[model samples]
Target: MSAFADDTAKDEWKFTLKNAYINRNFENENLKDTGSWSQAASLFYNSRMVDTPLTITDKPLKIGVDASVQYAVRLSSDKHVADTVLPFDRETQSQAPDYLKHGATLKLGYDKTLLSVGELWLDLPVTAVDASRQLLTSYWGTNLKSQLTDQLYAEIGRVEKVSPRNAEDFQKFSFTSNGKTEYSDGLNYIDLRYQVMPSLKAEYYFGNMQDLYNKHYLGLDHSFNTENFTLGSKFKYFNAKEDGNNFNIDAQNIGLLETLKVNNHTFGLGYQQIIGESAYPLPDGFLPETYFINWNATGFFKKDEKSYHFIYGYNFKDYIPGFNAAVKYVYGDSFKTADGKENNESESNIILNYAFQQPFLKGLALQYIRIDYNVEHGNDFGEDRLFVNYTKRF
Candidate 1:
């Protein structure tokens, strides 16, 4: 008995002493446990990109898989519209083959140190804060994040590719058909975030977007809480340099909200603007993360243009167990356009959602979208989308 006890003590002592003298760097940390897994799928109907001809109706299937080690895969397939034909085709364009994306990753960490390598979807340091679309695709990149303090963190990495389908395993994938231009190697970004107060944060980022251009962003967010109402503001600025002498490309957006609990209705008003080009591009599009809500009308947010948006939501706890619904509206005009000249387009959306108390089924949502465009100003694109989604997470 004494010998067995002595042996156990010796093993514990050895382990404690070994760990005490270990000199481990962040990148050399031993691989530990594998991560979790997540899967999501959705079905939708649209009038534009998904349905090329704008004639025959089509339904698209989109599926996604994400696992530990930052591995992710996305697959998409769709039926063709029977009424529309390509330029040379006498019949409707044949259905395109399913698109696939596969990604993989590895991470090492020690104490407050961290190192990541692989393709994975990340929304830290650089991302839209309130983007909540269930079927929306995510960005992929290899980033290293270090926890500088409890309230601050920093990250830098190369975005080898930007596809929601295959996140981390893009090493052998090439965007160009000829395989000459390696798109992944051409993208890089660095960003930081710090929490000034319990409810305020400041963020900054600098990066280049392959052949498109170079850009930087700065933003500040703050929230104030009182006994009856909560007030907050999101302010941001962007500077982009086009390869050649383009118009001074600069854009900014400011959103302010005030919320009070009176009865069961919540009312909020938002305003967003585009100062430079036709619109500020992040995620390479004009969809501002600020004015993203169903029912808000967003006219083409062009240079010198300002938009006013409004939102209303209601929580019905007694009617459907647990449910909430919202609606929004937006309107805008180009600042530099003459009174008779055409400007950008306008948009509106409405959404309704319900959540269940069951364990497996968390929530379900439905959405309707409408876009009215102005072709006279070279902004002739217009379309509509009807969508419904269900999500379950474990």
Candidate 2:
């Protein structure tokens, strides 16, 4: 950037490069004792796509380009299994490692508004896919976001293609793992957030996933800060219905979470209820719309299920900066499955995270997550995961 910058120019266009790598170790105690340890790298080139060399423009608008390629290499001791190391070396759950994760993107922006079209990253709750494994899930579509006012913001988007975090190549919208059907309607969304007061804020989101399903979400957040601690509360509700043939499902989910943070210690309690449906109609879609404090393992959304979670966290910043730990326990019951029998389940999760503050590794992070799920009737399993992540920008 320093080499391309010139104060004399009206608008400056700079080219840059960045890269990220992740080493993941995923172990399962109940799934045939199989584990997969893999390492993946994504190289990003932030440059224009045009082949011809063009002069830089100095104007009020800023134009940029981005492209990325990701490759995954499984460890020598490979235990080939389903759902082992996702988005990496797997034929059933994801694409094999040979298919590289690649995409090209273009951006046009100025001031507080921006327009993006191409293969891009959209992390919206129900719209965003995962990158937890070796590669990230990117969407093919267009988006527009702008700050309408000092207290209000709006975003609108239409995503036509999806390459899931655990899959290679783009596919159409579907509720199945292998997407053999494509939808021309695609997915559309509109979201808005407003700051009602210094201590209160509200957000609304609406999405239509072509002929599959659609959802409406409303949320409110309120927080209070005192000399000793801070208190926060969130309330969210969502209603979903099938559009055409959504596997015959319609559901409503409501959630509430309250947290109290005092220095290094924090505690939280959350509750979520799933009403109606054949599992919320989001099994194979994007992330669920649940705001539960303990969103781990299975979503715990059955035909008629109620879930409760307890959480505790601590930030060891005083002793070690950029270090934190948290644990949560969740239980779900009062569920009616296909057999008309009551089902019950429980889950426990623990995670430890550390972010590097050292100058040489400022953007590096390490995390360990362990989750245990117990079902009264269905399958029971436990997972242990370790992640080493790094990111940087110059």
Candidate 3:
């Protein structure tokens, strides 16, 4: 026993540590009074994979465990600003001084299939957890993934609860509309993907929230490659409707994107439209993954809205290694509010990113984002965000 313990102590464990600081301010008079200066930290651990005697197709079973914890706080001289920026508990009606999140999961694999149970992250078209904030949202449930053939894949899962990005504990899933919120029993989903050829792929997804709503998604992606440049195109569609005992929900969304990459530069154009009486509905605190081309800080999912966007990006690796920049602009109009008020809006964003190339700081990176937004007859605001990240594995 002593020898075994000594040997184990000599081996390094797999872990990661992350830290971030974020600051945001608004331009509107009503919103300028509140600002945010927040800090966050996270730790993750993954156990070494172990091979077990259980086998399905002459291959040994693999088992593992993963755990993570995240904490965040807001700093400000003004109490009102601090309270407004920090995480808030809707039920408690107060600011949370420190938002702490901890969870664990078990993983099992055999040949072409893998199973995960407990707290986990999901990235499906209709039910993806949002990870753009300080802490990522997570779900409590089970998921199974399998590779059926060389070019076909499938995933099925069920989640009962969720830990929101700003919350400390997991809670039941809920849907809110028109100042009314209703909780659902759970959510079930299935996803399928097939690679028709080397350059074309197709995907389909279906999600149902018990007694709440049902959603369906279909997507197609294709690309053409050449020695000098590459061209790509993507199309996405979504349909959603109410289930039972919920609000009357009927929505449809369609998006198309085209891109061309030449040397170190890329250009993109996109169009998105909403074609129903109701605005697109997503799970509370969740975002669509790769299903919405016009989704940025603000989405163009308003009822009967038509939006168009243009994007330009350049990679400066040859001139200045580890540097890239991009700018995007979107214009949306032809939408009406619930009270029949005409509205139009526009948004522009600038993004810059850099990563350290030196061996001593190989995993360190920095990012900056700027946003300018305007509404024809509503509040207007501008925002800025800076991020620093580092990661190491042992």
Best by TM-score: 3
> Where is model 1 more than 4 Å wrong at Cα?
1-97, 124-136, 164-185, 243-263, 282-299, 335-340, 359-394
Summarize candidate 1's per-residue lDDT along 16-113 as a digit string, tens digits: 00000001111223422111112334322111111122222342221112232211121222223221111112275332222233344454443344
Candidate 3: regions farther than 4 A off: 1-27, 32-35, 77-85, 90-94, 286-290
Model 3 C-alpha lDDT versus the unseen true structure: 0.77
Query: Better model by TM-score, 1 or 3?
Result: 3
Ranking by lDDT: 3, 2, 1
Cα lDDT, all candidates:
0.44, 0.69, 0.77
For candidate 3, write residues 184-265 as lDDT tens digits. 8888999999999999999999989888889899999999999999999999999989999678889998999999999999
Name the candidate, 2 or 3, with the larger lDDT value: 3
The candidate scoring highest on lDDT is: 3
- Clash pairs, model 2 backbone: 10-58, 11-58, 11-59
TM-score of each: 0.61, 0.83, 0.90
Per-model C-alpha RMSD: 18.5, 5.5, 4.7
TM-score leaderboard ranking? 3, 2, 1
lDDT of 2 at 230: 98
